[model samples]
Target: MKLVGLSRQIVLSMMAIALGVTLLVILTSYAFYFLWRIYWPEQACEDSWIPTGPEWVWMIGATICGLALAVVVAVNLSRRILVPLNSVADSIRRMAQGDLDARAVAGDRSLGEASQLADDFNALANQLQRVTEEQAFWNAAIAHELRTPVTILRGRLQGLAEGVFMPDESQFRSLLAQVEGLGRLIEDLRVVSLAESGHLHLQVREANLAAEANAVVDMVGDALQARGQRAILELDTQPVRCDPVRMRQALLALLDNVRRYAVPGQVRIQSHAKNGWCELSVEDDGPGVPEDFIPHAFTAFRRAEGARSGGSGLGLAVVAAIARAHGGHAECRKAAGGGTVFTLIWPDLPETGLPGSNRSGRA
Candidate 1:
C-alpha cells in the first residue's frame, strides 16, 4: 500500500480506538457516581464530588480535540519515518533479487537517519556493482590471455605427434620456450590473484634493497646484452623490511619489460632511501610512454597503442600487485631524459633482525 495513505489510516485507526476508550471511561465514571449517590446520598452533593454533566461534556470534547491534534502529528511523523524506510526495504529486496543497480529514494523529504541509511546503502550497491564488473572482466581477460599460448603449444605438439614436423633440437627448444612462457604467465596470475585477495605470502625481513636490485640486474645482464642493451646501476645501499623473493620478482618483471620494449641503450636500475621509504626504479632512455596511457599503465592486461605485442600485458600489473603486497605501491612515469621509468616504492620499516634472512649485503 502507499506509505503515506497507510500512515494516515493507521493514525485514524488509533484515534478511533482512543475515542472508544474515552467514552467507556466516561460512562463508567457516571455509573460510579450513581452508586455513590445510592450508598451515601449526603456525600453526592459535596463540592469536591464529580463535575456536572456540562462540565463532563466539555472535558470530553477537549480530550477529543487533543486526540485529533495528536493524530495529525502522528501521521506527519510516521510518513517522515516510514516512507523512506519502506523505500529502503524495497531497494534491498530488488538488490537481493539480483538488481545491482537498485537504489533507495533519497531526497529532501528523507530526513535524519533515513537519509544516512539511503546514502550508505547506495554506496554499498555501487561497490558491489564495481566489483562484479571487475570480476567479469578478469574472467574474460584470463580466458583470452590463455587461449593464444595454449593454441601455440597444442599446434606444435600435435604437428610433432603426427610426424608433420621434425622433432629436432631446434623445434624442441621452440616448444620449451612456449612452455616456459606459459609457466611465467600462470605464476603472474597467481601472484596477482593472491595479492588481490590480501593473502600474498611474504617472508618479510630486513634486507638490503640495493642488493635485490643488483641481483636482478646481474641475472638479466646477459639477456639485455643479447638484445643490444646494457644495464646501468645507480644503486644506493638501503636496508628495508620486505620479502626478498617477491621483491626480486617485481624487479625482474620491470627489467623484462624494459628488455622487451625499451630502445637499445642504457637501462638504469636505481635504488635509494629517503623519508623513511625505499625506492627501486628501472629507467631507460628514449621512447617513453604516451602521456594519456600513464594512468592505466599498471592495470592488468592493459597495453599501450604502440606497445610490443609479445608481452601478456600482466608484467606491470604483477609489479603493482607485488608492491601492494609489500605495503606500498608501484608507479610509472616519463624520465626527465626521455624514457619510461617504472618504480616500486615501499616503507623502510625499522629493522628487526629475523633469522634465516635473505639479506644480501650493500650493493
Candidate 2:
C-alpha cells in the first residue's frame, strides 16, 4: 500500500468514506421501520409486511455503487496532479546522479507551480555544472603555471648556492631572471585570488564596452609586439553600465593569455550588441584549444594538457570571475581560423557621462 501511488490512496479513502455513509443511511432507515411496526401496525409504513428486507437489499447494492463512483472520481482527480509530481521526482533523482540533461517528464499537460519549479531547478543545475567544471580546470592551470617558475627558480638557486658550478655571470643572470618570473607569478596569483573572492570593490558606472576593448588593446599592444604578435581593436558604438576598472582587469587578463599562446600570431578584439546584451570578445590566432580542453581553459591553474606557458595561469580565471561579479558572463571556445574566442556578455546601459572615467591606464 505504501509503495502504491497517492492517487490510489486517495481513491481508496474516498470509497471507504462513501461506503460508511451509505451503511449509516441504511441502518437509520431500518431502525425507523422497526419502530413504526412495533408502536402502531396501522401506520407501519402504510402496509403490514412491507418487505423492509427487500428495501435493505436494494440500499446495500446502491451503497456498493456509490463506493465505486467515489473511487472513480477520486482516482481521476488525484492522478491528474500526482503524476507530474512523480515525474519531477524521478527526473530530480536522475539529475542527482549527474545526468545534467535529465528533465522532468511532464506529459501532454503542465503542472502549474510545480512545472515552474522543475524548470528553475534544471536551469540552476546546468549552470552550476558548467561553473564547477570551469573551476577545476582553472585550479589545475594555476598549479601548472605557478609550478613552472617556482620549480625553475628553486632548481637554479639550489645549484648556485650548493656551489655545484663556478659563480659565473651568465649563471647569476639566469638566477635573476628566474627570481623576476617568480615575482610575476606571485602577483598574478594575488590578483586572481582577489577577483575570485568577490572581496574586490567595484566602482560601477556607465561606460562604453567598445572603448573598453580599445583601451585593453592599447595596453597590451606593446607586449604583443614584443612577442611578434599584433592586437587589432574593433568596438561597437553601444554603451553599457559597468565598472571601467573591473572590465579592464578582465581584458588585461585575457590579453596576457593571448600573448602566451599567440606568439607569432595575432589577437583581434571585437564588441557588439546582441539580444539586449553587449558582447566584448577577444579572438586569438593560435593553435585552437583542443576539443576537450576548451571547456576548462578559463579555469584557474588549468594548463592545456601538456601545453606550456610562463608565469601563472590565473588570467582567464580572473577574467571570468570579474565578468560574473559585474552581472556578466565570460566564455571561451574554439574560434575560427583555428584559435580560441573569448566573449564577455553584459547588459547594455547608457554611459554615465562622467569625466576622466577611463581606468584602464591606472596600472
Q: lDDT at 307 for candidate 2?
A: 72
**Candidate 2 deviant stretches above 4 angstroms:** 1-146, 163-201, 206-222, 235-240, 272-277, 291-295, 301-306, 309-313, 333-336, 350-363
Report the lDDT tens digits of candidate 1 across residue range 1-363: 444443455566577767765775687568767777898687677784668664587567667766776677667766766766787899999999999989887643435566667778888989999999999998998898889888998999999999999999988999899889999999999988887877675677778878877888889999999888899998887567878778899989988988898889999888888888888899998689999999999999898987888888899999998888667889999999999999998876643332222235311
| Model 1, residue 245: C-alpha shift (Å) | 0.9
Given candidate 2, what's the lDDT at residue 59? 67
Q: What is the lDDT of residue 145 in candidate 1?
A: 84
* Candidate 2 to truth, TM: 0.53
lDDT of 1: 0.81
Best by TM-score: 1
Best by lDDT: 1
- Please, what is the TM-score per model? 0.81, 0.53
lDDT of each: 0.81, 0.70
Q: Cα lDDT of model 2 overall?
A: 0.70
Each prediction's RMSD to truth: 7.9, 8.7
